[model samples]
Target: MGPDLWNANYDELLEIPLPKQVQLTGFADDVAATIVADSAEETELLVWSTIDTVEDWLEQHRLKLAKQKTEMVVLTRQKRFPKPFKVDIGETTLTSTRALRYLGVMIDDKLSFREHLESACIRASKTVSSLSRFLTNTIGPRTKKRRVLLEVVHSILLYGAEIWADILKQKTYRRKMAAVQRRGALRVTCAYRTVSEAPVLVIAGAAPIDLLAFERAKLYNAKMNGDNSNEARARLKKETLCEWQNRWTSGEAGRWTERLIPDISVWLSRKHGETDFYLNQLLTGHDQFNAYLFKMSLHPTPTCKYCPDKIDDAEHTFFECDRWKDYRSSTEEIIGARLSPRAW
Candidate 1:
């Protein structure tokens, strides 16, 4: 039978009167029943009763419950249980687990979601490693690499974010998410590993992953409350972008990037722009520039190799250095504008 007819058949389980302290919910073929009682004996009895009813319904439909796949978890703040909780299903005995995977989300008894976050990060890191073969600091289409990172890796990491996004408020969890994004950002920007997170993200034109999770959560809540999806998403985007901008401005890192693209909204709104090696170098200040080399302790001094008086940073190399002055002038002439941060 089709899923609709199967669901209609399943609805009969809801009609069976559950105890006042018991509740049952179903999604497609999966059924989850919850029971509250003072003791393990009462809880097990209620659970067995519910399972019996469910098994009977399944048998009537010519289906058999998979005892091996069935899982149970008891959620409580108590440090210890007085006795082990168990329920018999046919010849198999089921026991409570500390954590279980439900609908692709790892849910622990305490609902801390630490296991889920760690699992997601591990999966995302694997994706990053796999992508590294084709996408690297010196190869691949920048935009395509970024698109894969966002659509694939990000989707994996943010699965069920609306439910567990609050965990991001914890610094430890936030760093785990950021580390995944930082690796992807490095690939996208073709930046050196020495480049900090903020500048790489700015150059990549990607929002902070934590803020994106918050935005996802907010959008989910808005849609749940019957708000217009499009309107709510737009509002959340503006708010999140504003917050990103605030962090970027206040942060000690990415000051050079901030100078180049002061207004993040403007940078993100561009219809046509790709970050290649040269552009990445200019925006991130992580190229062969003596200033960056010296900062990384790879160079003897930060002075320009061509013009010894001036420091060789992105700004000096682009605007003031005599080495690239002719190329800069020709480029400005072609664009009919001076090469300055305002021109960007």
Candidate 2:
């Protein structure tokens, strides 16, 4: 089918009423729709009517609904109980599943992102293995290979991550994502998988996926806060960020007196590419004068090249180095940020 014609017809057909509860989430030959109800009976009624409406709409549009491919899956919290009945769609009964792959995300009945995380990890691993030859560490000439790998891997890893929260959630998913990132770093840098991936990531200018996700989530939260059109949305959006931050500060990172989250995501989005690159280096502590590497005896000298008196480490260079102290002071005054917990 031609793109324009198919899209026009599908768009027209999808606007049909599928009951008040069921919502049309996307428009296409393939759509992911949802319906929420209080009870099984109400849900069933809505589902039945939705199917009927879809069928009638298809008929009116002179297009046939593919009964064989059509299937329905209901997500519920009842783990031990079997579905009392099945949803009938023509001759085929729609099958039920513990997990549903919607828009490339695997959402299980529990609303946990575990399945999606696992799926993304698997896809990322396969990409790493399949494209090993492209390693100027994952990309080469003009960043073509790197761009392709990122477009595929990061897209899978961070899909819908804007909705990520910590409450009633597990840290295992973050660990898993970090593990995948470490593996990619090792592969690209040709380091032993067991070795620390920090240096490799820094030298390669690669940002960890978990950090990237965290930054993106913060950006999404900021955007929601700035949106003023709808009251309900604003409240929910604010609540989402507040809940996540509260859980993070109180539960997992309670020891941290100052907020660990920098407004760098917003900065990255608005700033130049070079600035973004530098910020990542700063956050990861993996810039040109990497002190930790010198401690490992990877570099010839640990002393600051600009100021021979002071050790040129991340902390010193970025904060206390004699050479940059003036610059750092001016920067702090301008941004109104001290960049340290004890600096105040």
Candidate 3:
């Protein structure tokens, strides 16, 4: 084995890269050239960076070649080849909450598995986002707005669907998770503000909190090492309620934050009386109650020179003002006719 034999044999083949050369003809000639080359140095560096044995190179190269020759040929060129197969992100059946987390987004020159856990979470979150969008578009308008939160929650809960299908089927599983189930329900209920506390017309009719509230609560529960947890739950509860207030105040929902809160107050008045009050309230006078009252209030205007005062809270706008007598009269008439009936 010397350089002459190696050069004479491989000179024609080595002109092109191994991957490209491998396509025109098998790697047999390449292997032979590397074996009979001038020194082990050339063979090691240029030919066999993997190992010394011909058999080792052949075995590995065969698989690599098979992949290159397959559908991956075009993919390899596009840098999309050899995508590691994991759970499909676009598939609705995958439901893994663990995937909602991520370590780092950028990969270094030497890629390691430090980011594996986080990467999994990122992928899962992305999949949930995708599925959520799909479901939102498909489920129709009534429930479409909740697409983001529901998709994420379903993905997290049912992530191991194949494994958990039997567990989910058994009523025994729900019984074991009675604590979690209760907490989940509480998260949903508490994430919403009572009509009385914030009386906004939009929130009067038992408008549910966004699904993010429940998902965040569940995530919080998981972080607590399976001990029943309310830290995430509590944060989410306030976060969602606050979001409603924010949106309403910003005028996205066409109502004044303060004046509109009375409808919410009225709605909450019904719930303060019983356990599962949202349900119990309906059994009595809840259905007849008008949550729509708050939404109909005038949009808050900052430059109301006619408001007679600084134009602050609902009390200032409605009760103590003589400046806007005409506006007040109109309001009185509407209230007397519309809301007074509901109150009595």
Candidate 4:
């Protein structure tokens, strides 16, 4: 806390424990110690000892502990003891809390993600509202608006989704994500609140929350397990996708993530990356023509804006619209075959 004693710069002046004494980790202003135990009493002693070591180390370095700001939580499937039970470090009685934050994540004793999901949704919604002005009036290129939705709102919504993939289980949490996605789609398509999300998503070329979260989990798992060694990094480029998918299907993520994204490699490929439109629509399923999130009311309307007689949708806009008559005839003639626009 004072000068980092473990730091290489001060290693000569100050010495710390060898790695075997206790697993110690510190960064910035926070420090943590870990120990293994075989019983509840042993676990309590170990935790207190670990905390004491950290406190003593700080004291030696002339940094005092902030007892009032310090708190602890025991993480387990079963509450080891009642809330009244306490563990003491020095004169401070360390009480168990319902939740505590670690590395920016709010983790409760039960490990449920409801709190985290709610926090993320609130942050994302605020960001969307703050930056949504750019989405109005078509001031810049469509790509700019798309970037705001993806980089700002989407980034916050999907933060650490891979580590907490269990969020898929909570209906309320998943609904929060869906709600935010729909809001973004509304901005993207400039559709009225009563409009259906199906066409709006298609027009916006944006991926839905479920698929987006699963894809993020897949990528996160891959990065966490992969090694930094050059040999590991360079392994089998030709079959990397195949291997990754195979490995993913064997893990817990395989249970549902695989179904969400059938073609793992193609989803990860750069085939559509060159163009945001193609990327969102084709690979990410962020593009048009699906009714996955539409409701008859309180959702976006599904009527075609250009041709009021037909449903306004991706399929109609691309091929079946009266407006595309000339282009459609030329396309058929060029292909030298009569094709249904339903080929999509």
On lDDT, the leading prediction is 1
Candidate 2 lDDT over residue span 1-344, tens digit each = 59888887688655775667778765457766688877776776787787788778878878776767665666677654356446776677776666777767777766776777888788887876665555543234333245445456667677778765341135677777766666665544444343454443432345555556665576667667785546545565455444444443454321221222322233224433322334434434554664646866788887887788777755677767777778888988997988563442
Q: How many backbone clashes does candidate 3 have?
A: 22
- Candidate 1: give its CA RMSD in angstroms: 2.0
In Å, residue 52's CA in model 1 sits off its true spot by 1.8
Candidate 3 residues lying further than 4 Å off, grouped into runs, are 1-78, 82-222, 225-235, 256-258, 262-266, 272-344
Q: How do these models rank on TM-score, best leading?
A: 1, 4, 2, 3
Off-target runs (Cα >4 Å) in candidate 4 are: 1-22, 34-40, 137-143, 196-199, 224-344
Clashing pairs in 1: none
Candidate 1: stretches off by over 4 Å: 82-84, 88-90, 142-145
Using TM-score as the measure, which candidate wins?
A: 1
Q: Residue 66, candidate 1: how far off, in angstroms?
A: 1.4
Candidate 2 lDDT for residue 135: 57
lDDT of each: 0.85, 0.59, 0.35, 0.58
Listed in order, each prediction's TM-score against the native is 0.92, 0.59, 0.24, 0.61
Global fold similarity of model 2 (TM-score)? 0.59
Q: Worst ten-residue run, lDDT, model 4?
A: 283-292
191-238, model 4: which lDDT tens digit per residue? 455444433443344655665676666555556788554444344343
Worst 10 residues of 3 by lDDT: 67-76
